[model samples]
Target: MLLEVKNLNTYYGESHVLQDMALSVDEGELVALLGRNGMGKSTALKSIMGLVKPKSGTVRFKDKDIAGYPPYKVARAGIGYVPEERRIFPNLPVLDNLAIGIKGGKIDAGNPDAWTVDRVFKHFPALKARSGQKGSHLSGGEQQMLAIGRSLMGNPELIMVDEPTEGLAPFLVMEVRDMLKDINKVGVSILFVEHNLKVAMSLAHRLYLMGKACLAFTGTVEELDAQPEIRAKYLEV
Candidate 1:
């Protein structure tokens, strides 16, 4: 496994948000963490990124235990996170925002080729055109692209993206989905947290359904489509 998370738990003060969450991702695979709102999916991603400290559990990346490491340390462990909020620096130019997140280090021998600004721009040509434009001026789709581009500048081996399609137009959502597929084709393992079932089914090789702070289902897309009871019980609004 490129990334293995075992028995992970996290809390926000008095509230326990994640309970024994476990998942794994291998090189070149795109896995979906699917759930409705407020079901600990984003918290699981945060715990992996070290934005929210896990109370207990093991986060192993490339055979090294990285649980409880700080955010920068987690980033250094070859994990990159694109948050659902699209945390772009509004005053900064698009190119500069990406430049800010770039880190220099030796590339992992087993991972895909590292990402460069030019390479990321190729994946997102709209960002290329807006390179000199301020982030505050871009549309929601463009800002989301910049967010992903910035994370790629770090050259992470595993990427955890939260809600890449949220609030995007249907066309732009499809575009982002394709972009993620292209990224995976280049061998970066992906752990995607998304609420859009259609997008999730289209992009993910496997699906993990989360509920009440625990994993409720794990299966292929075809298997999930066949389980109407699972959908009605956990996914239907």
Candidate 2:
């Protein structure tokens, strides 16, 4: 497995947000973490990224145990995170936003098909036009593209994205979906936290549905489609 998270337990102050969560992504795979609001989807991503420290768990990446490591350490471990909030620097230009994501100028040999600013521009041509524009000037879709592009600049073996297509037009959502497909084609494994079932159904090679602080279902997209009850019980609002 490229990334394996086993028996993950996390909390927010006193609330038990994640309970023994476990999932895995093989190299070059695009796996979707599906769930409704407030059901530990983002929390699971944070726990893996070391943004929210887990009380106990084993996060193994490329045969190495990385649990409890700091955020920088986790990033250095070939994991890049794109938060749901799209936390780009407002005053910085689009190029600068992408520039900061380069890990010590480049990634190691883990990601053979690495990303550079020019490569990012190819994936997101809109960004090239806005390269000199400040972050605050871009539209929501443009900002989202920038966010994904920035994370790609790190050249991580696995990239975890939170709510990537949330709050966007249908056309823009489809655009992002194609963008993700292109990224996955280059051998970067993906663990995506998505609320949009239709979107996830279209892209993911495998699906993991989370509910009530635990994994509710794990299967392929066809398997998920075959189980309407599972969708009604855990996925449908």
Candidate 3:
């Protein structure tokens, strides 16, 4: 497994947000997390990323325990996180934002596979043209692409994204969805939270549904399709 989280329990100022939550992601797998709003879907990702320290739980990546290690440490441990808000460096130009992801300034200048700024541009051509544009000046979809590109610069083995397509035009939604599919195709494992059932079913190899801070269901696309009641009860509002 590239990542394993077990018996995860987290709280937000005395409000219990996650209880015994468990999930896993293997190398190169695309995993989707589905749940309605306020069901702690974001909390689970935050806990794993060390953005919100869990009261008690396990967050293991690459066979090492990373629970409560802090966000920078988690990123250094081969996990990149893109929060729901798409926190880009609003004042920085797109190129500068991508530069920060070069962890410890250790990226080999000659490695082709390394996530150099040019590599990010090659993969996201739209961003290449906007290299000099500040993040705040970009369109919503452009911002999302920059955010993902910035994360990729870290050369992480896995990425945990929250609400990859929260607020955007329908066309942009499909574009971002396809972008994520292409990113996964390049061997970066993904665990993303999404409310769109169709998107989840289309992108994920497996699904995990959450409700009231607890895991309500886990299955493959075919299994989830066969069990419609699970969605009707836990997913449909």
lDDT of each: 0.89, 0.92, 0.90
lDDT tens per residue, model 1, 1-237? 999999998989988889999999988889999987899999999999988899999999999999999999999888999999989999999978888778754333454576777889999998898889999999989998888888888888888999999999999999999999998898788999988999999999999999899999999999999998998788854
Consecutive 10-residue window with the lowest summed lDDT within model 3: 105-114
TM-score of each: 0.95, 0.96, 0.96
Clashing pairs in 3: none
Error of 1 at 161 (Å): 0.5
In model 2, where is the ten-residue run with the lowest total lDDT?
105-114
Q: How far is each candidate from the true structure, as Cα RMSD in Å? A: 2.3, 1.8, 1.3
Which residue pairs collide, candidate 2?
Answer: none
Better of 1 and 3 by lDDT: 3
Q: 197 in model 1: Cα distance from truth in Å?
A: 0.1
In angstroms, how far off is 174's CA in candidate 1? Answer: 0.5
Tell me how far the alpha carbon of residue 123 in candidate 1 is from the true structure, in angstroms, after superposition: 0.7
Q: For model 3, how does the per-residue alpha-carbon lDDT over 1-237 read when each residue is reduced to its tens digit?
A: 999999999988879999999999999999999988899999999999988899898988999999999899999999999889998899999988888878886786676777888878877788999999999999888898898998998999999989988888888888889989998998899999998899899899999999788999998999999988898998863
After the best TM-score superposition of candidate 2, give how far the Cα of residue 172 lies from its true spot, in angstroms.
Answer: 0.4
lDDT of 2 by residue, 97-157 (tens): 9989998865545754668888999999988999999999998899999999998888788
